[model samples]
Target: MGTSFQDKSALVIGRPSGIARAVVEAALAEGAEVVAAGRDAQKLRDGYGDAVRAETVDVTDDASIQALAARLGPVDHVVTTASARARGLLGDLDRESLLQSFNTKVIGPAMLAKHLSITESFTLFSGVAAFKPAVGYLGVAITNGAADFLTRSLSLEMAPVRVNAISPGVIDTGIWDALGEPGKAEYFEHFRTHNPARRIGTVEDIAQAVVFAMTNRFLTGVTLRVDGGEPLT
Candidate 1:
């Protein structure tokens, strides 16, 4: 059976931008009462207006996540796109950066599962880095891989409440804004030639996939790859 969010409630944790923002918009369009949670309350309010209830949350802190859970009561779906970027070669990595990366990408969501009274499902954000490990993305690969494992484990433990991970490939989510216009264009062109889809993924692609994972009755303990077939290459 398929799921609809006509009257359901969803909590999205992460910055109110990029793929996270797209997910919030999509959820609202589907009639879900959405709550946008992140470290920036004002940013959330500014980005989403009154369409979503902006709540502050620091996923790295257990207390913060628990407190937010208490405030929201129960929710039908929980989607955490929260992450911290730690880029460096394995030998050059620092202990603090590595731990912080794991704390945000893996441990944070694990803690949410422990505390939140979720009624339906929990969808975590993994990435293509987990599969196609790059030179400077060692820390990201490790944390994302761990998150995928955590999702599977939680699916078994959480039972009736489904758990899954969405591993998105190189998407044009403006996360590459740091690359500047020229660099961003080059990046996409490189992927455009190589990826099987011959194009980059989009925020809408990921958002729709997330909704599917949340509503699909029998999909749990799985990592849905929204990558443009990059891993296969």
Candidate 2:
């Protein structure tokens, strides 16, 4: 394959999740030195080993993100999978719930781009919710929509740092554990019928999309949807 991240280092956040892990792994596999960060230091270490430098980071906190950026040194790329799993309809969602979710996904990644001198490319996680709305997903849609706009706008101000977002649909990233058994089963059944792919997404699938955007050099201020054509149908 051709080089996408030639002679560069990458700083990846939220390495605990499958999608984040895959992005870090793909960056490494592409010959980039990775400095991976997550809330769980031991987990990052355990998951990535010595080949990937690990840092303890909570993306929701400014200090934690600053410390992470400082530790990672100058980087040629930045990517985040730092969102929390919280879902509710607007009527049922409280201020704290909304803020907490945005704090992780919206504010966190935006702060990273503002504070850190990310290289030519920066990638943040959006979701299909940004465009295709569903019931009980108002909070996610708002936060992700905000993130998409922020990513695009930041790309202009950040200049050479081409900022973009990835909108993945229903990736089977063990995040379903938060939904409990019944909710999880319900989600699977819903996707089995509604999604065009007839299955859930893999982390590697999202990872490859991220890697493509980061290294493509021409893509910026865009949200690449890796949803297996679910939104089309």
Candidate 3:
């Protein structure tokens, strides 16, 4: 977090809100030149203002990812926080939804790792749902599980260049806004008492974990469980 990021270039691809946006802000604060890319160009610009170079890339599309890689010649660090959630029980799960989830969280990043000229480290996103499955988390579980696997295998394949994954707990990213205030509050309240952390996670928690993964050259081929002991309880 100190001079590690200073004078370095980073490519952060994800949505402009929640964990992605927070990572961008954190990298900028660390004096890294950050290029923020996501599916939404306007939101990326709006979220980061003049602080970042906003661009567009859809993780589900290989061509889009390839094009983005071509545009970004080289970078010291690359972090992909993009993910898609298909919320349905196994019985109701559709093939396309499951495929899309894997494509975004796994395959897309796999392509990114293959094409991007990453000099320092590459960080991907995973979630506690992979280990702690819920009623409608079939898609989340498998996709996140695959992402963690990718982190390990890629670290070996891309040796000398660190590869890590960040597995976050239920964080207060605006993702819960879809459930409305009452539902979100009730959901958080339940986790507040259920998890050993006794509180929900924040975007900063995951962002700082990413910074650690990027700066610590020796830490590689592992998934950093920044879930605040959510899987323990």
RMSD of 2: 2.1
Residue-level lDDT tens digits of model 3 in 116-214: 889999999989988788788878998999999999999999989999999999999988999999999999998889898899999999899999999
Per-residue lDDT of 64 in model 1: 94
Alpha carbon deviation, residue 86, candidate 2 (Å)? 3.0
* Better structure of 2 and 3 per lDDT: 3
Q: Report the lDDT tens digits of candidate 2 across residue range 133-221.
A: 88999888888888889888888988877888999998887878889999998987888688888888889999999998898888889
Error of 3 at 230 (Å): 1.4
Q: How do the candidates rank by TM-score, highest first?
A: 1, 3, 2
Candidate 3: where is the Cα deviation over 4 Å?
A: none
Total colliding residue pairs, candidate 2: 0
lDDT (CA) per prediction: 0.92, 0.84, 0.90
lDDT of 1 by residue, 73-125 (tens): 99999999998878998789999999999999899999999999999999998
**Candidate 2 regions with alpha-carbon error over 4 angstroms:** 1-3, 178-186
- Which number leads on lDDT? 1
